[model samples]
Target: MRVQLKHPARLALALAFGFITASAAAAQEPTPEPQPAPAPAPEPAPAPEEPAPQDPAPEKCEVVIDAAGVPINAEPVTVKASFSRDIGQPARAQVASESGVRVLSAEPDAETPLTFTLTLDTSAGNAGDWAIALEGEGGACEGTISVLPASAPPSR
Candidate 1:
């Protein structure tokens, strides 16, 4: 035997069916994800720093004066400067008086790689200790001169 619902039972069944339909529709729709707080707008980065300028490299060469002959007023003396190593080619020499000594002339050795001689002298008024410097092909040498006054006795 089939049992049919009366008026109150039919109304209760309709209310239950409507509630289930609403729940199913709500579940089918996409739920909005909790939006992450907009990443606080990024602060501007600082500009990159410029590097400092560098200094020029210093000159480097190891050379020496072989002999700076004794100095006598009004008398020319020969001074020789020799480089520690062969420069692989002929070199031009530049001579300058470091002190008050006079450099009469400079000449490079014909057969040597880096060797030269200087003719140096001091006038009677310039007699005393003086300094001379020679530069050639990236090398430099300095020497002292002990000039004797005209009145001084000759050295043995």
Candidate 2:
């Protein structure tokens, strides 16, 4: 079929058709969806704990030399010492000599004074100064002992 129309009328009709097609397509299309909010930031982890500090060791006991008995012949020498702190019952005593003096016996006098007997080894040349030590639950102590020459006479 053939239809005749003027140039201006053809242009107007074409423009109207294009406008109607664009409006129908826009109405039929679906609307865009909204986006969800971002997740909350995670909390930081806690720090580790440190250990507590320790205390220092206690000080050693004090000992004072009161008197020392004479060393005569082959007999043992006696030493008396006073303790600064009270050592409980069943205290321990020891002797250390520079010239080979040996401890023969030791005893604690109730509380304060501690007595010890040191045997002079004439064969090993134990005729000089010696050191005595005493220890117990309370604390510890140290003292000294002196011996005369073998040729010297006993004078205590």
Q: Give the lowest summed-lDDT range of ten residues in model 2.
A: 115-124
lDDT of 1 by residue, 45-93 (tens): 9989978769755444444556433445566767665656544333433
Judge candidate 2 against the unseen true structure and give its global Cα lDDT, from 0 to 1.
Answer: 0.59
Give lDDT per model, in order: 0.60, 0.59
Clashing pairs in 2: none
The number of the candidate with the highest lDDT is: 1
Candidate 2: where are CA atoms >4 Å away?
1-57, 68-72, 89-91, 110-125, 151-156
Model 1 residue 90 distance off true place after TM-score fit, in angstroms:
11
Structural RMSD, model 1? 11.7
Poorest 10 consecutive residues of model 1 by lDDT?
87-96
